[model samples]
Target: MEDKRAAVTALPALFADLVRCETRLYNALNDRLREQHGLTTAQYEILRYLHDHPEARVADLATEFAAGVGAISKGIDRMENLGWVERRPNPTDRRSSLLALSHNGSDLFDAAQKTFTTRLTELLADLPALTTVARTLAHLRTTLEDRRIGLPAG
Candidate 1:
């Protein structure tokens, strides 16, 4: 354990740890969300965003989630088919439609949010310095988002 700890103390090792941790967390969350709410993580995220940004368009969601518009649109189509979301013509942009959560979507999101938090807490239960790590990650995420490095140009 001491040797392993020493190995991960370096920057590259820490980055590898971060990547693996993210993958594990995402897979667990995706599985749980799918089993409980019929939502993949990506779909749940779209619903969550629509809940917050009631007037979002596909482009807006793609931008917010760092996904391509085509991918976002397909997810939206699935949710809309499930009666979890609806698209209304964007008055401002004829080519894009504004996305909103349906009544079912809002209810599902409310329930799923509880599951998400509970599962996340369970997953992090034994981890040390969770608060500090969360804060640091938030800062990193904000900085990366602002820089938009490695992202495709719009």
Candidate 2:
């Protein structure tokens, strides 16, 4: 009975630590991307995803990013205005367009990739248990994704 109570108390603290760590890492990465590439972390993520998955629709991106369609649409709009992404007609679905990285967007993503790697390396260099922690986090993320837990439905 005592062991069960201890395990329950420890689990929430572990989750809280995970959340705090994620927030810090996100903020740091965002700051570096903003400073070096004039892009937010979210924008970089979108561009990177589009680069790898060409012709993905906004809904697809929203699902991948665990964001709402409206939010993804707005981000795509801003990127479109900046000529970072181009919307092409989806031959199969006329109502939904496909997103592709523009020439400039591809260039920016390449640069941002270097910045992201460098910044992340610097931030995580001191963590001796990075591999174990990363594996745990990956498992957690996969579990959450499988369950669709806490994610907004598109």
Candidate 3:
């Protein structure tokens, strides 16, 4: 009773702290990327994912990114305009298209990847415990997924 109440009382504080940290980190990273490469964080992430999974279809990519179709479509349109990706008609599924990283996209990724890696590395270099951070973030993601919170309703 009292013990459970005490534990519950502490949970909000812990959760708030974790959320604040994650939000700050995300904003900072996005800002840095925008400053350096003129890309929004979401755009960069999408490009990276497409670069890695060139065979992924548009719907699959939207799901993988936990983003809405409209959002992904907008991003893809922008990427296409930037010559970073191309949409090819999926032979198996004529209705939906396959999104693949273009040659220029690959080249851009190769050129920017090192700088992105270096920046991320620098950000994490002074972290107190890398493993703990990874584990905590993984736990948070799993919890969110399990609760069906913050994810697009399929």
Winner by TM-score: 2
Whole-model lDDT values for every prediction: 0.88, 0.94, 0.81
**Model 1: per-residue lDDT, tens digit, 1-154?**
9888777678797788899999999999999999999888888888888988888998888788787878888989988999999999989879888889999999999999999889988999778998899899999888988998545455
> Candidate 3, overall lDDT?
0.81
* 1 or 3, greater by TM-score: 1
Model 2 local distance difference test score: 0.94
Residue 83 in candidate 3 has what lDDT? 90
lDDT of 2 at 35: 96
Candidate 1 global TM-score:
0.87
As a whole number from 0 to 100, the lDDT of residue 24 in candidate 2 is 97
What C-alpha lDDT, on a 0 to 100 scale, does residue 111 get in candidate 2?
Answer: 99
User: What would the TM-scores of all predictions be?
Assistant: 0.87, 0.94, 0.83
For candidate 2, the TM-score is 0.94
* TM-score of model number 3: 0.83
- Model 1: clashing residue pairs? none
